[model samples]
Target chain A: DTAVSQTPKYLVTQMGNDKSIKCEQNLGHDTMYWYKQDSKKFLKIMFSYNNKELIINETVPNRFSPKSPDKAHLNLHINSLELGDSAVYFCASSQEERKAFFGQGTRLTVV
Target chain B: GESVGLHLPTLSVQEGDNSIINCAYSNSASDYFIWYKQESGKGPQFIIDIRSNMDKRQGQRVTVLLNKTVKHLSLQIAATQPGDSAVYFCAEVTGGGNKLTFGTGTQLKVEL
Candidate 1:
């Protein structure tokens, strides 16, 4: 079974289009996170939810919003995506301070 | 302003040879550190981890060494194989928040 899964493995959209990436984890973890990996392969934390509560919000712009319906799910919604939005979005989940398990990641490309 | 960074962006090694990837962090408060391996088109997979309390931890064929005084960490792989070719990343968690900060990845190419 896939412990952490993200939908839309690949996404290509226009410059002004909006998109949403879904992430779900079956690990029963309390902490769920959204990360952005740039072309340089630098992983940066965008948002984190602990038990459906917003915990970590990085310097990301307001165009990106993360919603957590529950502890098992965290979805990212991007409004008016731009060229700079092109990157790989990854979903991860962890229990307490233990190691985190990451999903396959969704590649987002804005033309 | 704390960040984790890698020294070398890429490393090439021969099959059956040992490989070492180095990382440095500016946060001295970080107590937990982990090493992750990411293949092409895949997410980062956990390989090994070490805490500030310990200087070294060994896994199947991977070893993680942490130096708290210098805030440096290293991952050593024994008998690297072609399947081991991937990007290796080092992450740190601080203040018990469990938020992992990943360093720049190091691409490891194992040549036969």
Candidate 2:
């Protein structure tokens, strides 16, 4: 079974549109994370949630918000998506300080 | 600001040849490090990991070397196959291991 799963393998939307990506982890991990991979293949952490508590928030724009309903689920909501938001979004989960398992990413393209 | 970076953006190797990818980090507080492999249209997959306490750790055909003194990390693959072609990333874990900082990826191309 896929340990970490996220919906919508690919998304394409026009500028100023809003969309959401859902992520769920079955690894029973306590920490979940959202990462953005740019066209240059640079992976940056956008947000991290530990036990449904916000732990790490990078310098991402307020247009991007992450909500964790529980330790097993973390979803990303993008408001008024801009062209710069075009990239791959990944969901990951880990147990404390251990290695993290990642899901197949959702490629977001804003035209 | 703490950041992790890679030296080479791309590396090409022949099948059956070993490959090495290098990374450097500016965070000394990071005690745990992991190496990940990402194929096209996929998320990064964990390959090997090493803690600050150890200099080297070996997996099936992968090896990760950590140099805490210089804050450098390296991942070496033995007998690299065509299937091993992918982007490799090195990540440092800090903030009590809750936060993971990833370096720019290195694309490995294994040619037959």
Candidate 3:
């Protein structure tokens, strides 16, 4: 069974478009996070949630919004996509403050 | 600003040989460290972790060594195989925070 899973392994969209990537975790973890990996393989934190509450929100643009309807799910919605927003997005979860388990990743390309 | 960095960007190793990847961090108050492996087109996978109280930890064929004095960390893999080829990252958590800051990463290529 997959501990953390995100939908749309690949997403290709044009600029000025709006899209959403969904994530779910079955590990019953209290914390979930969204990370972006650039072309150079640099992984940076974008957003974090703990028990359906927002915790960490980095310097990401206001175009990106993350929603957590429940503890098991966190969805990222990007309004007015930009070419620079093209990157691999990963969803992860961890219990307490320990190691995190990541999903395969969603490669979003804003063409 | 706190950051983790790797000495080498890429390391090539022959099969049957051991491999070592090194990382350095700037955060002295960081209490936990972890190593993750990421293959092509995949997310980072947890390899091993070490708490500040421990200097060394082992799992399967991998061993993690942490030196608090120099704020350095290393991962050693025994009998490196072709399947072991991937980008390895070192991450740290400071002051018991849930945020994990990752290093630049090292690409390990195991040659046959």
Task: Return the interface RMSD of the candidates, in order shown, one decimal each.
Answer: 1.3, 1.2, 1.2
Top candidate (DockQ) = 2
Candidate 1, overall lDDT?
A: 0.93
* Candidate 3 chain A weakest ten by summed lDDT: A93-102
Candidate 1 residue A93 Cα shift, in angstroms, is 0.6
* Clashing residue pairs in candidate 1 (N, C-alpha, C atoms within 3 angstroms): none
lDDT for A21 (candidate 3)? 99
Better of 2 and 3 by lDDT: 3
What DockQ does each listed candidate score? 0.74, 0.77, 0.67
Provide C-alpha RMSD values for all models, in order: 1.0, 1.1, 1.0
Model 2 spans with C-alpha error above 4 angstroms: none
Per prediction, fnat is 0.69, 0.77, 0.48
Model 1 CAPRI quality = medium
Clashing pairs in 2: none
TM-score to native of every candidate shown: 0.97, 0.96, 0.97
TM-score of 2: 0.96
